[model samples]
Target: MKKSITALGLMSGTSLDGIDLALCSFNNKKSGWSFRIEASETVPYSAEWKRKLREAENSSARDILLLHNEYARYTGEVINRFLNGKTKPGLIASHGHTIFHQPQKHFTFQLGNGTFIAAETGIKTIADFRNMDVALGGQGAPLVPIGDRLLFSKYDYCLNLGGFSNISYEEDGQRIAFDVDPANIVLNYLAQQVGKEYDRDSLIAQSGKVDDTLLKELNDLPFYNEKPPKSLGKEWLDSELVPMLKKSSLPLPDQMRTLYEHIAIQIGEVIHNSGTMLVTGGGAHNPLLMERITACSKAEVIIPENKIIDFKEALIFAFLGVLANQRQINCLAAVTGASRDNTGGTIHLS
Candidate 1:
């Protein structure tokens, strides 16, 4: 493949944090597929934009469509600002901000318009990576496993703590992945209540006491009892999680601490509390949470370099674009329970 391919990847995760942009170079060598992050940055979302995205979860059909195009334009502008005069990559791969992801209902939708992105940036764009798997009677979630299997197979487990926490690992000669539990989504919401963007190393949670009752309730969530090939979404958060948290009269810090411990416990259950695991995502930066995870589990959680922690999702989305262009399998049926392994994504020509 002509030495290597450079692609720009954009990720608007469920965390309502910001858009992550990574310009990555990929090479398929005799050894295996490898990638290098040439440049990357995260443009934090404005309060106004974040409010619109959160509210769009239940907005009218027409409003959702308008927001889709508006978000695409916003994404493109953010990319333009980040690129600033740097050379454009060959392709743009985006995991558009998920406005709705109800796989059980047989539909999933991401907000950024690929056609609009392509037109704005004058680069071919690939997005909407989840719909096909849902259509195939699969979870249509956790599409990142293919990249985990191909790019970071050295670790026994790959855990990402973003808006939500999800894990991927090899099992019985097949790659398995699924959401673990809520992470930054809930944490950030609580932080906002205290006028902070996040817990800042989870100081809030660390300084407080974990309410045992809340911890028990969180651990008892029915979603945890489900088998593999499952997923979670904002609907679950609103309908199941938020109301439960609201019932607690504990202070915000105690609530954060309880949930943090709960997240650690749920994650520990998956790894059986042991293995060499690679942890990445914005949540990786929370030293307090990381410490709790280590204390609760026997797993060796290795937090990688900063760029890898921040932009790995973006890099993987870019790899998905490369695979989609080549008609290669980028979404694994074994992971998402799709009818078959499929090359996910739709290409929008420049």
Candidate 2:
């Protein structure tokens, strides 16, 4: 048996939701690894921070660098507040906010300075988990599958509904995972048009009707037919998805309903097999969207407790940090199409 260690994981998803912090303890037994969530919280982004991140994709190089350090300090401050009076974790693992993710160009950038985080918090930090995979010609994404395989293998599928939807499962003795479709990214975009932050359980979507034409167009998207190991980025949404949505003349509610149906159809097509699928991420909270998914598939959707639904990614990142510290394989080649299975993450010591 391996000695148990506690670690704090920080996640800033593309949904621009907030910084999710999860403190978890992990132990490795002969059977496998097991973990318990000690605590978790979300620090919502201020309007200024949100706007800066939203525009980061277009920001100048100097500005990007400045924002990177600023965000790192902000993350450290959040961690400091959350950890006040708590037992200190052994490590801090951060999945920094993604500013650019064009793996095809052999580049992906997640902005949070690990050195700064470690300096500010006086804790060893691990971050920038994707660049090595991209350098090895991989998608460097959907990295959560390794956690699913080790921690939640009972389910036939594991799906995360964050800014985008991604699924992971075993096939022919290897773990396979990839981005499925846009989820909260599109939903939140439409919700904002109506002066709301998000659709809130997809209530706005449930109140309207699905547009067949829009559904068909969404279904016909070329990326959907691409082979596995592919990932989607904000650039794709800005260049292709949002533009297509703008072409439609539907009302806000109707657009939400139509996109909701589209997301369901895309996800259903991938996991049509009959078995239990563990669902997490912000999208799991959308009951109406969940209904749409159930209506279109044979699989049973199992949503765990609220804490699991909201902070699974952060917990997994913490687990990934544990693996990295041990020099164990954390990122899988089968999932990312990298040259080989390898450990990926940069560590910073204060």
User: TM-scores for all candidates?
Assistant: 0.98, 0.99
- Clash totals, every prediction: 0, 0
| Model 1 bad stretches (over 4 Å) | none
lDDT of 1 by residue, 121-195 (tens): 889999999888888888988988988999998999999999899999998899999999999999998898899
How far off is residue 154 in model 2, in Å?
1.1
Query: Best candidate, TM-score-wise?
Result: 2
Candidate 2, 1-350: lDDT as tens digits = 56789999999999898999999999888898889999999999998989999999899999999999999999999999999989799999999999999998999999999999999999999999998888888999879999999999999999999999999999999999999999999999999998999998677987899889888998999999999999999999998899988988888788899998999999999985899999999999998998888888779989999999999999999999989988999999999999988888999998
Clashes of 1: 0
TM-score of 2: 0.99
User: What does each candidate score in C-alpha RMSD?
Assistant: 1.2, 0.8
Candidate 2 off by > 4 Å:
none
Instruction: Identify the candidate with maximal lDDT.
Output: 2
| Candidate 2 steric clashes | 0
Candidate lDDT scores, in order, read 0.90, 0.93
